[model samples]
Target: MSMSTSSMSAMSSAPSAFMTPASATSVLISGAGPTGLTLACLLARQGVAVRVIERAPQPHTGSRGKTLNARSLEVLADLGLAGDLLAEGRTGLPFRRYFDGAFAAESDPSADTPPTPGAPYPASLHLPQDRIEELLRARLAELGVAVEFGTELTGFEQDGERVTARLADGREVTAQYLVACDGGRSTVRKQLGVAFTGTGEPEPAMVVGDLELTGLEPTAWHQWFGPQGALMLCPFGEEGDRWQVQATPETGPDGTALAPSLEGFRRIIARHTGRDDIRVHAAGWLSSWRVNVRMAEQYRVGRVLLAGDAAHVHPTAGGLGMNTGIQDAWNLGWKLGYALSGRARSALLDSYSEERRPIAAWTLETSAAGMAAVREGARTPGVGLEAVRVADITGLSLGYRGSSLAEDLLGGPLRAGDRAPDARCTDAEGRPIRLLETFAGDRFTLLAFGHRPALDPAALDLSAHLRTVTVDTDDPAGLRDTDGHARRAYGIEGDALVLVRPDNHVALTAPRGGEKAVLDYLARL
Candidate 1:
């Protein structure tokens, strides 16, 4: 039977002790955080059956990932959630610091970040991680997929054919693959015997929580310098007068988790700002946060794979922990879907680990450096951008240049494996559009720019899944670089062809008449 037929058969199976009713999905995901939710939502959109389970009875209410960078905005834009997210987010908010209740220098954190034709999102956005998960969950619901809350993956054993996972409710779920997005202390990673190697920062653990308080302007992001550290109170979303507070108490250096209580919160608020009048009315979520710098040695072990916090954890320095994980899901989701549907071989799934692992390692280092700068009093809390550049912080500078999937041509600065930059171009009707719009949806897009194109749509034999847009030099076809923006952005002097993968990265670029080269590159990936 075909893979889709087999997948349907699995979903239609009856319940039993060894395999339960929920055992039918092709991919089983653990931990319904942003990472798992994104992966689940992506797969579901592609008609891949996925079962997502979270140990917690309810969705997390904490505002952990408060900043969504530019690349993350692009990822969300791909899911059609960017418009709603932008509506619910605050943008280009300034960061102001006060020392001893006296105003220090105020800095526009994202002032230097200008939107480009290809990259339209802002430097960063102020939407909480909880809100992001809500969006993903809503998308999943639209696809008829609901997260299985209160269901935890106790353990799982995998083989060549399938993976059988045991839930906390004494149920068994058999799936073609298993992915763990369950935080840093991942049970799946542990069970798979993946070595998580890193050291935990011994600095006194800090507390972060969301609170509804009075007497603070929700416009400017505030930071108060204290004897211990900088106290942060960032306003998120325009819905109400809510804020996320991060502060460290002067309690003796005891290795203990701080309890999130009203009294404790008030005390920290009073101690840090030396103000007793600011009312701490009620708290929404509270938790302890510490610097744990770690990464899994391998992203996959057999049928079990890891993403998000399950695979790596940073000090929340560059605000990249959540964004990187979201990108990870975006990278893995479509590939897994193709593999599950048998449109692509299982080798495509291997690229998930190979591509994401290095990015995670780089994120860990950059975030670690940012954390060190903050702890050393050289930078303000939540203002690590002083140490990190705009490109790195926005995650646009990252590319799989050395990736085996890339095929480079010595024409433009952007080669194969580079992110295909956006440019203002016109379609056949002379209507202006950006590359982001053209590359929307889950399909490989081929752009034949300016001349003797490497690939031909009429004569070429290609997969039915591929999308082709032809651009001409003199007699323009479907797409045209009217003002030579495409020529400049894509490095097309006379003639060139660019093949962009589903994730918006250039898979292969070749000189004119290199049609066979492009085909060979596609076959290899």
Candidate 2:
């Protein structure tokens, strides 16, 4: 059940104006990875015309990235797909580090509180990237949007108003916006002559094939850091049977590819696990990838924009690559929807690069730092600092600073440019709910404090259409208890007002007396 065929056909048809053939296409997204599929799904949900192209004939089934942070879960919840994903995926506890086959220190995700008020899925979820993409594809199909697979985006011609993409099959697709989710070796980024500058480390790691283990206990993930190197054995399935074993290679120079032979893989496993009799299943997919921390010089050039590995590619040390790409889609999805719908200014699209590029750079830098610490064998004071640093690779610590969204505050609490945290609260019926539950729908939320006072809703309209929610606070601390991270991140104090965008960023904040301040801010959006 794709989007109505007639509507899609109408969207594909050329416009009557002479601006450009590409501008006639609403939004054309390249690559059907999680980023492209997510952007497609969100835009389609908002009734925006969108199409996704992929070079692969089908979705990737291998277990690439298996960790999903709390912030990513919030984004999934916003799309109403978190429940389904959570049902199918396993939520592992924080990763535990090991040294010399002994327990080192454990990194607890629950330790850090969420930064936004009323955020759902505050805990990191452990799900394979393939599963997440599957869920996203299913969601996209339900919206009547099928990905055009086996189709390659050969080249593109971009003018001031639109982008004309030349497909490998000699077909021309014109789109108002061209998004490149085309992985690390992005043709789009190269065509734009965007330099991906970074250094590749000489650490050779081997991801073992899909193996069903027998002897090792399936209680938790096991990481062995010995004289040889680091070997991490993590559970990939529910019954704790199937596992993904990663070990540093014994013989391989820089740029030399490791042979994916079963003998070679078993030798490393025997060296680390101290078991030569362990049976090996048919190797699913085994290869070595260099660890490089790189980001595109710019995320956008004219009508072309970049996301996922195209914008930035970093070491898998922190499992941040996929999560960052997903977040990139979430940030760009709404902006594209608004702009294409003719409800937002073109300048609003600029914020996408402004806000996300810095975050990507930070992710690249942090991942490199964590890899350096691992190489240097930097151990924390108590447990191993390597594990703590490895845990940070998830990119959950990212936050936004210096943006129009985050500005002056009169100091009641809850400031702009903060990642909204979630808390447990009750509606008028006294039913318990999370703060993110209020923002389940596809609209902006204006969280108002105090009693049912006389206020004009239209004054707070940041867009032509917006959603507002007024929650009277009886216990400020109680609200914080529900979502302390959001309160502190936003600087929400007693009797203060807060405006949260659809994507959960604090758009406006005001003191108790400045209701007009909030009103005027919304009018500007």
Candidate 3:
């Protein structure tokens, strides 16, 4: 599992992994965007050789998707980049909704109830896509991994054992697996001929320039649902006081196929704010994109798999697009690393599509509904007027179901496919630490409780290959109440041990006395 010096050099030299040798390329990820870069960093940390390819010459500076949920923050924390990101990024505090330029409802993320114990990250953070990429790139550089830019995957061929991708420069690189993080127009997805079944709703909105307001009071996020469609103004960061404004375009048929002009953008802003003197700084990024709700027919076609926008594309109403992609990579990265390291069976790869596709479908539907609500509000002023629930807008409620791991858990509260909640606990040294802090690095965790006299730790000797943390709890009442779902999910109650996967899902739960059963489970994996 050692990374070759040549692969390290390739990551530092090229924008894509095309220059890296096949022997050094265990995982070849196309597109070094957030999802691909995050996956590369995760694999590299685990001693897996990962090569990332991107068509863009360098990191994109556009103000694209700009919301990160608690789940995504947890994944970043695992990569050791969450602290830096939180410092650089702004928190979506005092969550508020505006109707016709009037405040409707508001709540603070920090004031919310603490998550059930054992969960990793429990709140959302607001960071622009560019800033997030910057953090991810910094992390990859720290791990001696760099994304190869200006490299495009022209074509690819997958065999029984590996996948070989042909680059635009006529270079061929082979790897054990090929992941497509290339955006909505993914060539890999098209090459596989997987149907992207979805329709686009015409949004005749011309979101104008990155303006720095003088008199406009800036809060968390301002959404205006007037007769003129939805106008959303979101704060980017402290520097320059950049704000992204989205409003309906007076010209064109529902704003379809109409180029966004600065003049057109200014008019929309003036119409909404009733101020024509607002100074425009610079149009950092501007484009009109109609909402497209679509998901790949399949996430995998042999060794070639799809992730991020390549797998699904939905409206930005809920800001779930980027977050969903990152989660996909987080789930797949560890599984691929473990399986490639010969610790798990190839069938483990099937779970990627099984667990992720449905989630993507749900995101698409949810985002579509949100967009429909917004559009309806635009058409019939204040028709569907209701406070935008934080869960709906944040995309935190999305979870996995219908997997073998989940199905085995039955209808218990802590069954498979449920997110493992976080809890506060004291370590051996009596130092207070969070359960997520235990999973900070990329590794698996095992939680053990109850009084079992003959439990043998040596039965799970894979510790050298896997990370194991055993929390021996004598007083069940001392355990975090949020752990009920975790206990039920693992089918463990009193005097039991539960093995958690790297993604924080329960892998196996066994009674504390049944060391043999636990050993058998590890051996099977």
Candidate 4:
């Protein structure tokens, strides 16, 4: 018997071609950072075959990328990891500046705005990056996936259909896609010949790391800028003087960049604070980094794709490096899952670069500008936070308002490609539920508002793939909006329809008669 052309095409991506008898790995992720772990978990939860490999032999303990902005918390919540994070972390850490052992100014990095009906998470919170990674690794483990530590992607070759990755141990694994979540020095990116282009600080930035100390209270994030150089210490972890220390290195007369060390940090802190009381102990991970204000010329080269620091690296002013990468993973996870399962055409994968590349460019601009403003002792750029009004750092308004998938037939406050706001409501049993909860898991949510234009369920029967929820009680999935948050957020004064994508972004919003447009949109996907 001969195989049909379509059947042959399917066989090209069939898991049987490689690995165990079960199936070929659908996706292979490189690096075990938050970005890689989040992507691995999302795809694995959907029952997609995913394997994550990290060059590091064990989990890192560095407190790098420490800020979890509101949008990041929302993403974590969507993945079911937010509760533990919020409970373990505090949002009240204030930034304080001291000069010559006297306090000068104090400011709040986390916003103080009240939670709205549409958005529940606080504006910003501080949690160590190591803790966040541990949480993500825990979540990934729950999905029955583990990062293969000490395993590195030595090289790989991709053809028209599948990517074959060579492990450091000389083993080859084939998959439908290869995603590089590796850091600034990405081997996968280099192998792809993708140019990481932008300006790097002529002088390499100094070291920053976590240190267990004595005499300093964890009450406020302490910083001292004196005649020598500046050193900042922010308390981290659940307790004690487990603080992150960031300081400028003491350069000699030769103008050579000196290596970062505990002694160097202590000396610099002493010089800046002019205090002998603070004692540095048990020094944790320390490394120097010049934030490479660079981004990949493109996000992908055929079957190999880049996310996280692999795609872009910038200053830590907004702490957006990790958040952007996590967002990149989320955006790509659902599209890849559905496409691999044949729910959507493979071409849908092209949107990954289209939707994310421009956002990364904007992140570069915001981060660079923010860092510059901080150095010049000014507020953040108009695109970033104000130090006092740190809400912009939350990244709530960051959306793909210009993506091709976004269609705005009926324009309003929330347009196509905007982040779908959440609202509190109850299930049919009158049990408590949130709008964000409904959008959770792996399915597109079709929000049929209390029919400003009157939508009937018989009009569309896509239950097999779509989760339809009717706000204002007209059907089985209806929610009685007693507080009317859903109505207000969706502009539900009249009949309207909203189609949210699997990643919880508004894909289409139109009047009630636009049901066919919704049906047609899914059919095309």
Candidate 5:
């Protein structure tokens, strides 16, 4: 698990330039995990000054939060990282289960689902979290920003206008806003005195680790459930022998949990699967997991904010933890960009907590329920690790339908506050284009269907923040919906307009003559 050359360079290249008391950035992010890095990437793309700090001395090598669902893929696709990620990750792998020493069942988790034109990424991608962080760090470096490792935030205080934070080294920095992407035990959140209320499992339930093991096939996720308890070894990484291991905790005669070790994991595997040949030669990232479901009561406190695990921590049953954090960063990135650049009023920042906190609440409940169902299913004779799999885990169905940002002026199934669905079309040159590609970048996108809207960008006061694309159904002059996929996906047979946020969520849906509605909605933000 060596760091990539580019990653090491990026780490070395980030000097203490932002460590001075007079130093200033639009956004100061604490923690360089997926959530913090995502926010940094988005802010950097918008030309906002951003600094990401990680307390860790080096990049994490653990295989934590190992799956990115369809929604997160779409979010990364907007950042132009999905192609490289898909090439490196595996998708649609079946789950193989065993009862004691005998094979029980095999099922494709995504058996019935097929990729549609609008939703091209229908499956989750399995890759190590450390590798994902490497990709994000490289992208951040390309944007002239690198994570400052080993820089811990000791304390912070914020006024109405700015936040000043003190580092462990006693250096102070100032920023328009500060974000905490630190894990569940967040210093920032703790200092804010925000209550993180939730329940926890009675005790540590499982031991998790990454190991190079033998006596198992590397094609599919293998699982065994027997009197010795459950053991799951998922094939991962480029190396064939590498696996992500999760096993029921091995306890002492007094029922006390044993610390995870190579020999201990080896014994657990052999006993659970009844396979004497299985051997665990090397192990990394060994740790115990206790189910804890909690979320911050508020996502914001004055000029400071909390995101990712800092705001919430839930059971990992549905593989929702990392994806949820990435989405939180995505949702907040554009709002922060607009607020900092004066494109939108600071009131726009309030919508970040409004829109994202509810999603975290839902995530806590959903993951807890999933954990309960899996525990119950494991007691049955036929069920295996597949019991932990949850349906609609893609998160595509989640939306901000109830948010104030949603303006359903033109009522239909494709309403505002919904994810702007992707569609296929051809440019005037007859080159292929996707709606997502067109929507990619740091500005709002206005998709005008059937014909170009008569509204003037300058008149709407969105000249700096908006990009409008005309979709023509019949003409070869602009974007042509040749196969009618765009029209069908949008449920529009005639002239219409959809205002998409920088985060790829719909803000307003207006008819051909409803230009004022779109303008008024932007005015509110």
Candidate 6:
């Protein structure tokens, strides 16, 4: 019916020295970007004490990392913040391109694909990275945790028991675990001596910045390609005048490109577009970008772990950078919570690296291929933005099928480690509810199917960490799959049970009487 009140209370009120002035916190997360903020919100929702620190004085102003893929949006929706993002973000915005200052073509990459009942968000959302962080901060604040800005993790040391970190503000914090989401040049990763192996582009590829510009409509993403290079101005931020400027650098006679500056940006814009009417009034957050593909060999060292860009950094071609990092946090949050709660062994955290490291490797490959496609398109006439491949960028097809956590006792269309699909169902009162709504909270979900009988949640010995829902075709008292959407999505025809993880991946599948297999799967974690 509901979370076992006694079990939840016992776990939440578990005695922790973390509340003491000496111990400080349960988890100490460095870098208040999406990765750290998402992990903090998840852990806080489970009543775990978390401390987040950012070296910057305030929130980042630039509209950096603007794309949120469908998978990341689903995770945000589970956290109850997707509504705010969808309300503010623009979706299905067509690409308006020009060649040599003349109109070329307009195309929408996500035009063919539409949202399905199982996958509601099929298109990506275009929103500034800063706004995403602001929403996450608000959610974190509601959970009674505030990100400490200007507080830097200068260094840290960890043993088998705990982590002791020293901040630039001369304060030392002690926590059960430490996580680094501090971007590509992570000090923690460097201190851990993890090898970041990959090649880098020697030359500056592009200059990106946020600016206030006129002569540009805020309706579509505008691109200008000419002899000098390519320039793209996409409307973003909360105001009508704001836009993100990305342009190729102008090479001098000496074979060196000019560095990114406001004057340089204006000159490049004028030369590329062959128009001086597009005024650049003010510029902010300018930086020269180069293609660097690198990944950490391992994600965890002792009690300190790496996440986000700290673990991997790849080309910014398919907008996978931010989404990959956000998903990384989602995978780790629950494992960390289980470990800290003492309900699971500390070894459970090792799966975090085993499962996610391969995904990052795959992302590096996908993004590199996407970058190559963009380059090939640039050389071909009339290719325009259509050259950027739009397949699998949504991240919906990704799964941990090879993971050790995946248990395959019963074979079916959806196997262990597959993403659990959502379906429309109803309660005994005939009220409609989505499958994702039932899986939203940070807990394992057990879906028991068949008309014969159901495994009781209280008998599972995981009532504190699990929720059980019975799906029966004939029983009016259970969840009514009137349209058979749940059964069709899961490919179920008879009595079966599905166990889902906190990250919404199927842990295992079994027959009606196979309760031991379910407990064994969770015990391995």
| Candidate with best lDDT | 5
Across 1-525, the per-residue lDDT of candidate 4 in tens digits comes to: 232343234334323233332225889999999899989988998899999999999998888988787777888898899899998786867777765556677766564654688888887778888899999999998989988999887777677888877765666788999999999899888877778899897775667888889888788888765544456788875466578888767787898667778888888777877789989887888877785799988787667789999999998777788889889999999988998888888888889999998888888888887777655452212111233222367677778888878998888888999889889988778887889999998888888877533334675546646887888756666787868888788775877889999888999998878877888788788
Report how far off residue 497 is in candidate 5 (Å).
1.1
Q: Which ten residues in a row have the lowest lDDT in candidate 3?
A: 1-10
**Scored by CA lDDT, what does every candidate get?**
0.78, 0.69, 0.69, 0.79, 0.85, 0.84
What is the TM-score of each predicted model, taking all chains together?
0.91, 0.85, 0.85, 0.91, 0.94, 0.92
Task: Name the lDDT value of residue 46 in candidate 3.
Answer: 86
Model 3 per-residue lDDT tens digits across residues 352-431: 99989888887887777777676776554333223223354434455564566543322344544566656666655566
What TM-score, to 2 decimals, does candidate 4 have?
0.91
Residue 444 displacement (Å), model 4: 0.7
Backbone-clash count (model 5): 0
| Predicted structure with the largest TM-score when compared to the true one | 5
Q: Which segments of model 4 are wrong by more than 4 Å?
A: 1-24, 378-391, 452-461
Q: Candidate 2 — which residues are off by over 4 angstroms?
A: 1-24, 94-122, 201-209, 252-257, 378-397, 453-464, 473-493, 513-516
Higher-lDDT candidate of 2 and 6: 6
Which stretch of 10 consecutive residues in model 4 shows the poorest summed lDDT?
Answer: 379-388
Which TM-score value belongs to model 3? 0.85
Model 6: per-residue Cα lDDT over 107-186, one tens digit each? 88877766777778856899989889999999999999999999887776665788777776556789999999999999
RMSD of 5: 6.5
Model 2's lDDT to the true fold? 0.69
Q: Write the per-residue lDDT of candidate 5 for residues 232-290, one digit (tens) a residue.
A: 88888555567898888989899888988899998888787877877788998999899
Compute the lDDT for candidate 5: 0.85
